[model samples]
Target chain A: MSLFMDLNLPFTADKKRLKTLLETAAHLGFSTVAINYFHEGQSKGKKEIPKPTPLAQLVDELPIVQGKSRPIKVLNRLTILVSDASHFRHNAAEYRAYDILAVQPTTEKLFHAACMTFDVDIICITVTERLPFFFKRAPINGARERGVMFEVCYAAAIRDSTMRRYTLTNTLALVERNKGKNIIVSSGTDKPLELRGPYDITNLAQLFGMSEVEAKDGVSSNCRSVLLHAETRKTACGIIYTVKTPNDSQPKDGPPLAKKQKTSAS
Target chain B: MVRVKSRYLLCEIHVSDPSKLLLLEDRAITAAVKDAVTSAHGDYGAAQCSIGFSVKYVNAHTGILFLRCPKSSYRLIWSALPFITSVERKGRRISCFLSCLHVGGTIRTCQKFLIRYNTQQLHRMLPKCKTQEEKDQVRRAILSSSTYMLKGKEHKEERD
Candidate 1:
């Protein structure tokens, strides 16, 4: 069985509240969760990107996921709100600290650019407002081919009824374009109460226009794929590095110590 | 003979404060569920929820409840259960969430599942007992509960 994962828990400053959020997520049977830090690049003043808190400083002992014998895995994610093409810096040093990178494109052109060229794991579909531009087929297909997953967060829908309409509308539009391929449903929530169980999310995904199997994959297998894609984005085409021993240069080597293996599984 | 088929949803209510569970009422949960269904599925879901829908059981002490709905529209109700964030009592909201544990065709099957679930929970809690008295208390509680259930089952069989 595929492990359930909720990849976008909004980063909160309060350690107590963050702990509760992590505990709640673990109780809901999420095997892995990512703490998402939002950075809006459109705003002026040259603000610095926020650094992720070390996992040790946040929680002393990680809560074990319910029904799963192991403790929950926490990862840091950076979501850059891209209004213009230049907003998303290509291969920035700051992004290396994060386990996953995502972009929320404000305009259609930026969306196209994000899908086709950006080296990111996730493209967040705007759920707070109506989608301004239609999701063009070319960019979506390109993203799918490149193994970039599209994310639809359900936190906004839980908070307000108006946003719920927008969430459903935008999610349906996305589903219509993507046909439920390479889509993930994550809870972009700051509060612990807003987190829903993985099965609950799967049921809700069906309401968002995904088939039952596709809905299940949205919370499980597809999220795993996104994690794998993020792994590839961090590496040089998923290359294996081998350390060259000094004695090997003296022609006293047995099988050259280690051979470099290139595995582009992602 | 045509028989009415319905789905029983076994759900556990998880609250941030356990004391607030006393404020929960069947009517409030039903209202909250109805409100969530209306918002989630719109007017169509509301119509489906109103027909053959009822809260079959509510155990405030255990924070468990059972909801019955027509088999055709149970998914609408099951889907809406997650959106219910609270149950309002006397204009005050008790923040909570409903986690659906199982969906059964009949209430009897749901009850059997609940018994098994509770036993599993008891096994998990057994290791946490620090003192011998506490461990004995848990063992006695488990034995008494299951024996009482068996006695009731035997009486029902005798009646048949």
Candidate 2:
């Protein structure tokens, strides 16, 4: 299979713990991992969204994947816990900083909106508590059509049996409706031990109603597609992310710095 | 006559404490696996799990075991193995993981595959030795094993 990825690892203030978590993820053969910063968008719209630390600052050196010789790829992701319809700011500038943007809609109405229209790479399904509402077909279909994936974190399940019930219940509901399409399973973990291997997650996905192929895809190809979608979300169709940097142009005939910067600013 | 179909799972239990491996009884492993299945998949899985499930063998030294389950529900049981975080006995918990080495229609096939797979693993580890002494030791061990196998084969041929 292609590179396996765990797209969500909870961001913590403790650097050592985060480093160990990253090391554990790398050791488990996750080629790509995202440091997830959870933001509850409930208060009077805080202008300054928390910024993700650069990967260099987070860890001195990325560990090589267990089987792959290449070092792990780390990305930043912002997961907005959207409880109200107005909580999600449309075209928020803060979102541009993150490589992946996700929204965890707590209510059915917000969930429907997130599934149908949110310009997010992933929609986090609640695993900490029983789903507040049933997953409807229309919204899930919309999400599938738009290439937005739903995320189910398994760390909660390993921690508490109650959360495990909720994780299974919510996963089953989503699977029953979507039939295992566009689902990404991640370890929303802070500790190193909570992270599981890719094959382990695939087997666990079978418990979530996915067949072998779909479960395998959920961890590998589907996450790749999500990353691609995020790339496109940043750039215009994965090309022209920023007006061609001056160095990319033939230096002899390159555009002026001011003009290039202006074009990139747009 | 209809054949009664079943699947046998060859598994290795990975535990931090080797001493605790002695406490892993068939019943306790069964309970742990069943509890994981019930928690993950609920009553339907539990009902399916109770059918024709048996522990064929347990190797305490190697921490290997063969679990037999009805062919139809093998995946259900197999999937639940990853959820088994540990095994407990006498109020002492041994943190362990169940890794399925092979699954086959018969225990004989599983046993054959495990033997071959383990040999392959040994071969793979030979090159990863850090020192020349270790490399020489592994090479000598492999040569001795192969010679031993050749002698056994000759003896078997003579008997035949």
Candidate 3:
């Protein structure tokens, strides 16, 4: 199963720290990393404006390959705090990252804008306090209305274990209702250290009412689809081809590698 | 590929004189149209009304609005459009028509309405229009300038 690690390093986190985190993720079998970066001065109330760091530099400098493994993909997390179409366009112009993980209570106008500007794959609705409002404004039906995939971050599920069932049930109902449109369920955790792997995430989905197949798809296939659609990764289809010398090639003379042939031989 | 089943209450109001349409006040009818649409579909905030549903066309002057509903809930809501105020058959199947005053209604009036009125009214009432012709009409109406204005108002309230 493919793994994705959310790299929520602080703005102050230097390149060295980021390198260490990427190394750790690569070592642990993560195929993709989603880096969440927001302007600090906007929130910190600092008048002394720091020059905007080019996001492209981070993408270019990120250690995507370790040793001889396939290069790990890096995606910038463009979380729209409140759905602002202009802000999304501005961000798209500035960063031009592969994908956006937008938070909602945003208008369909803005959602469409982000998708058009950045070619967004997954629009994550941050249903923290505004669960009802979030569902109302950007209803599962509305996502279908706008012809876009809608993702729900189970904040309450991750925060309070007791609320997990309810969140899961409601989210599942939403997913079932909008089955054709893409629905992604995530734990919306910011700290990379606290994230859960695909298997654990699958287990959580199962506990919350997703069938084994559904849970597996949600964590592995669904998550991959989201990350791949983001700006960081160019291709979502995880197809890799390896070329080998004639001597290194496995023998095609071995009965076409079918299990039936092996069993018959045995 | 997204199908929504939306329910709207179309009240004829039984005005004997058709020429007295001016005295009827388009706003009142529009308000009723808005109320029926909201009650049947759910509150989508005025701003979202235009873009959220399959509103083919609306002629507030003649009190006619054409809408689409997803197939799943079409039976529950669409049939009830003509008889919204009647309690005996509030959620039962019934014949409905679009006001000729509005464009495109004459051609697609017989189209079925799908309604699934749950506690969440807005999402439930949307119709799943399968045919490309029906889907295109709904998309155009929902994304029109008037509907976007309505959605913008609802959005303002959320921000406030």
Residue lDDT tens for model 2, A117-182: 888899999899888799889999999999999999988888767887788888998999999989
TM-score top scorer = 1
Per-residue error for A185 in candidate 1, Å, reads 0.5
Per-prediction DockQ, in order? 0.44, 0.19, 0.01
- Candidate 3, residue A21: CA error in Å? 4.2
Off by over 4 Å in 2: A13-29, A45-48, A60-67, A243-266, B1-5, B10-27, B38-52, B55-66, B99-102, B106-160
Q: Give the TM-score of each candidate.
A: 0.87, 0.75, 0.40
Candidate 2: pairs in clash: none
Interface RMSD over true interface Cα atoms for each candidate = 1.3, 3.2, 24.8
Best by DockQ: 1
Native contact fraction per model: 0.33, 0.17, 0.00
Assess candidate 3 and give its TM-score to the true structure.
0.40
- Identify the leading candidate in terms of lDDT: 1
Better of 2 and 3 by DockQ: 2
Q: Weakest 10 consecutive residues, lDDT, candidate 1 chain B?
A: B119-128
The residue-level lDDT of candidate 3 at A59 comes to 42
* Candidates 1 and 3 compared by lDDT, better number: 1
